[model samples]
Target: MGAADSVTACLSKGVGALVGTIIAGSKSFIAKAKILRKTLGSGMRQVGVLCAPALFTLEENKAKILAEGLNKIKGLKVDTASVQTNIVYSDILKSSNITETHLCNILEAHRVLTMPKGPFKLRLVIHHQISESDVKYTLSCIQKAVNGFIG
Candidate 1:
């Protein structure tokens, strides 16, 4: 419900993840904040440094990156128009003969990390830290992985 919605919304990078809404003067909000602060008590120091890069990343054209860049990668089934933000749901077709886990393992072996959503779906998060070259490299890696699995 906070910043990591995966929806188009400001394209908040993982560094800018917000777990709760900040509504000033709201008693409920204050109570929730207190509970989280006491219960969670988890945090990182010098967050401002991370936010600096996050702010820069949020400025790029996420829509274009997903639609034109990611979708263009062959073998990854993605409906680009539906991609309004930084999150992309990529599918490894069943016919591809590679499970999402295997694909993820292959990608990880090549230093590319991705999350497997299901038997064949992957939840891909692209931040500004990922460049066009990175995208190309990722696609190529996946393609190679699929090929290797098939062979």
Candidate 2:
């Protein structure tokens, strides 16, 4: 083949490979989605509500709020040396008398939210449903609950 024809052939082959790869990837993604929907018993549902646009907007701002709230806690320390994610973990060694259930109840009463990681560890998660003020209020509630439990 001539030089120009060789270059054209190479370009056509590259484009063909790219198209094939994209088609295969799409098929794989569709298959995975089908399997997940069946497993979750959502195959019959025509509409799925993962999150609305407003909730998506809230989710985009959740990380900063979580970081600020985690910082406000006194003895509860977080690993901030690395890039932080949406979850916050704190050690409860200072509040030995505070049970996980009690902490959960205190959070419930304050309309905050948290979960236990272990005997002396607690985990907090920030989501689109929670606001920055909620985080601050939760920290305050935790502080008070811990003090009351210790005393």
lDDT per residue (tens digit) for residues 1-151 in model 1: 5653222233244423332222243567666666776688645566577556555554664535654554554556887766655677887777777888988887887888889998789877776567777877777776677767422
State the displacement of the C-alpha of residue 144, model 2, in Å, after optimal TM-score superposition.
1.8
> Candidate 2: what lDDT?
0.56
- What are the per-residue Cα lDDT tens digits for candidate 2 across 35-78? 97679886543232422333343346555555555555665556
lDDT of each: 0.64, 0.56
The window of 10 residues in a row where model 1 has the poorest summed lDDT is 14-23
Tell me the TM-score of model 2. 0.50
Clashing pairs for model 2 are none
